[model samples]
Target: MNGKLLEGKVALVTGSGRGVGRGIALDLAAAGARVVVNDIGASTTGEGADLGPAQQVVEEIRAAGGHAVADTHSVADWDEAHAMVQTAIDAFGRIDIVINNAGILRDTIFHKMTREEFEAVINVNLNGPFYVSRAAAPHFKAQNGGNYVHITSSSGLIGNFGQANYAAAKLGVAALSKSIAMDMQRFNVRSNAVAPWAWTRMVNTIPAETEEQKKRVEGLMKLIPERIAPFVTALSSDAAAGVTGQIFGVRNNEIYLFSQSRPIRTAHTSDGWTPESVIERVFPMFENDFYPLHRSGDVFTWDPV
Candidate 1:
């Protein structure tokens, strides 16, 4: 690959102060995109804010001879989100790529989860992407070209024990991206998502010594730190044009595409359709392989082993 594959393009990454977000932001910069590094500087649990993370990322990019600007805007309010995009517009004169990697974890079982906890995660993980994407929507439409990648999680994809709020927010983000992709098609704006399992501060919280925990962590580590960025980078590239409304699980040097296609069958009886009949007719759809695997196409498949 050419060193300047992204030359003249502009990429913006949110929650890029640390971990997967930070890695993605740097990679974009390295590939020759003028980058906008955004971070609210909140803790892993979404508490207070700090400006250091954003500034630090900017410095790293600069030191590596890449172009970058730092934005401390929280992706909470609409205005802040708008300003965040504006920062990129004012700097590079055009917005080409967006990686919505900013997120927070408020892990609690549904029964014990508080409204505040729920709202906080929703605001940042789900609404934050909404704010940024909405702000960029018009600009993307005007440019006639753009790319979007939202960071999601397996916890949300498959559900986790203590992450009801986080899971809900992540799933909401995936749904939101799919919807936006349809609107962006006319404008050449492609929106997709990445569900990453990395040993970041969030995953590090799970104990690694226990057999169960070790197995889980090891399975995730298969998609190492650097592997995740390639998925985002590919999505951000012109090569991935028209590739929208998709979700990828990235880790351990592998990328797995996920989908939700069920054997949707409608039943027809001789003018007598009861609820019982409806249930009985649909029972067979529950059989294995009735639902085709989602996004299991050649361009986006990986062997779990």
Candidate 2:
């Protein structure tokens, strides 16, 4: 409440009815941004919709003397996603920040995953951001400046069991954010993605089959949504103006700058070679550079700080 970092800014945050999105919406409002809280209020698996969740967040923001409006629009729909941007423009006269945070999970091992399962997650998590960000691009360009904060996931950055669709969608988002940053840099529009590690309803779907698993989940539970809000708010504000096209991670007290993909090793031959020759020489040359098939847990083994 003390820091009016986003004073006079108009922000639109999708899936702001609950969890990490809700925390981000609240923090932006508290920083003096008039907010358009967009949430379809669907179940974790992307089924059914209600207005209760979005409306509740709007009420809470208003009670705190912040400006906010509820928008029960599905981010997956192109028309509805554009309408969300319009809602902010109609209410606040202009939009300055767009946070693509809407998402759902349809967890299953890759082999067992259905086409429907894959498409459902992709539509909401990946396509949803694409629609909303595309809709807002013109406005951002017109304004001469804007900010985009996308909610990506570590599941995609690393890998995770039973989340092939979710991971693919999230990784797509990070790539999309980077592309947006590059294309919109001339327009003064900054885009970045955050892979948040928070305990939310989607995370609860993971089964704790062993004592160690239970303990780990318990540790994750302590990394509440609130802990990630500050960094998100900072990224959305002018305070992070110099930063863009970067991937970040938030877990409890820890904030990570994730390394982007780049060539670790390369091999060259003086003459054109057959597949067999290349396999014998080039493959062995980069053996140490090859990454292990690590799952998300293998990378983030420690508890949140």
Candidate 3:
């Protein structure tokens, strides 16, 4: 890849103080885009705030001779999200890309989950992207071209235990990306979601109940966030104009294009049947089409390539 693929673009990345977001911000900068590194410096559970994280990333970019500015804004807030986008414009003169990577986790079984836990996860993991994307919508429309990259997860794409809140928010984010892609297609705006499997602080929280589980987690730790950033940077570039409203996954040396929901089977009757008749006939015909319940780990059992 050319080192200057994004040469004149200005990109904004939320929650870029560290981890996956930081990797993305740095990669975009290295690709020649001016970057707005926005991060509230919140913990894994979204409590407290510091400016150090964002500033540190910004300094790293500068040390590498890449343009970057730090913006300590909470993406969960509507006003702050807008300010984050505006910060890009004020600093670099335009916003050409927005990566909504801010998120928090509050995992627990549904029976034991609190309303506070659920809402907190929703506010940051899901609503944060909505607010940031909404703020960037008008600018993208005016510019007639832009890109949005939302960070999602396999937990939401499939399912996971003790993560009702996180899964719901991540899935909601994927849906939101699809809606935005459709809404802005006419103006050349493209939006997509990435389900990244990297061993970040969030992933470290998952319990390894057995020796096998512990070994699996250890293996995943080698799939660093940097491995995911190149794909994200490509998606943000003009070269990926043909791709939109899609879900993708990145592991160690693997990339996956996920299948979207579609009708697997259909049933009909010459005349509309009663509920009893429908249950007797239609249910039997489509019984085999029903999907078995499976969690995220169950589906992705192989080691990351």
Highest TM-score scorer: 2
For candidate 2, what is the TM-score?
0.97
lDDT by residue for model 1 (142-194), tens: 87989999998777777666788888899899899999998778888899989
lDDT of 1 at 92: 84
lDDT of 3: 0.92
Decoy 1 TM-score against native = 0.88
Name the runs in model 1 displaced over 4 angstroms: 207-211, 218-223, 264-266, 278-305
Q: Please, what are the lDDT tens digits per residue for candidate 3 over residues 94-206? A: 99999999888888999999999999999999999999999999999998999999999998999988999999999999999999999999999999999998988888887
Per-candidate TM-score against the hidden true structure: 0.88, 0.97, 0.96
Candidate 2 — which pairs collide? none
